[model samples]
Target: MENNMTNKLPKISEAELEIMKVLWSNSPQTANEIIEELEDTMDWKPKTIRTLINRLVQKEAVSYHQDKGRMYAYFPLVSQENYLQVETKSLLQRFCGAAFKPLLVNFLKEEKLSSEDINELKRILDEKTEENKRKDR
Candidate 1:
């Protein structure tokens, strides 16, 4: 069942992503542990947090396990990278005519990056370039 659910990606809301973040960082957290983790950062009530968790479960983005104590431990069914790929595709289609360069240029123009960040991007680009060259041969 879990394997089947993984093949279908769900559209996640920003609020739901917050709950997922908590789970992604540490799996199988109870509802209370999730609330505690986000309490300082989120200005939401316990009921609201639980509602989001419920929504995620319904969407198959999360699933619960029956622990030894008969308590339900919630864990993320969807991975963070997979969700990011969906979001990136959505953004590119919406704003950049599905073009990579325009989206990248827009981000570069808007955000200020540290030298380390720039170097890392350069390294990624260089690796991609090498892969493309190898494919051409």
Candidate 2:
């Protein structure tokens, strides 16, 4: 929810994000295995994938382990939900700023949400309102 998260986050670059996508989809893979498998989908060579893997490791986003002289695998340190929240909050803060009411008003005015979806949103909003009120004290 703060700029520090965006600015100092251990995030991978665009190229490395591809490897992360694979890691996120199927976690805990070795460098060689990821490189070999990624060739079918990505234009990058094995070395390229390896470089990305190294970069991801350095970023602390992905963790690795070794066994019997073989690097076993890696996994994402940050959950998808957390990552999504960070990105979405950044966008909202940048575009909507402190004018969330108007932002919501515009979205509600333009988008035709289903009744069920609206009800679900209302429920979520109620929970958030309760949380805000509790924090206000």
Once fitted onto the true fold, the runs of candidate 2 whose alpha carbons sit more than 4 angstroms away are 1-8, 99-123, 132-137
Candidate models: Cα lDDT each:
0.89, 0.78
Q: Give the best candidate by lDDT.
A: 1
Worst ten-residue run, lDDT, model 2?
Answer: 3-12
> How many steric clashes does model 2 contain?
0
TM-score of each: 0.80, 0.68
Score candidate 1 by lDDT: 0.89
Model 1 root-mean-square deviation: 3.3
Looking at model 1, report the run of 10 residues with the lowest lDDT sum.
1-10
lDDT of 1 by residue, 1-137 (tens): 64464457888899999999999999989999999988889989999999999999999999999889887799998998887777777677887785888768888989999999999999999999999999999
Each prediction's total of clashing residue pairs, residues at least 3 apart in sequence or on different chains, is 0, 0
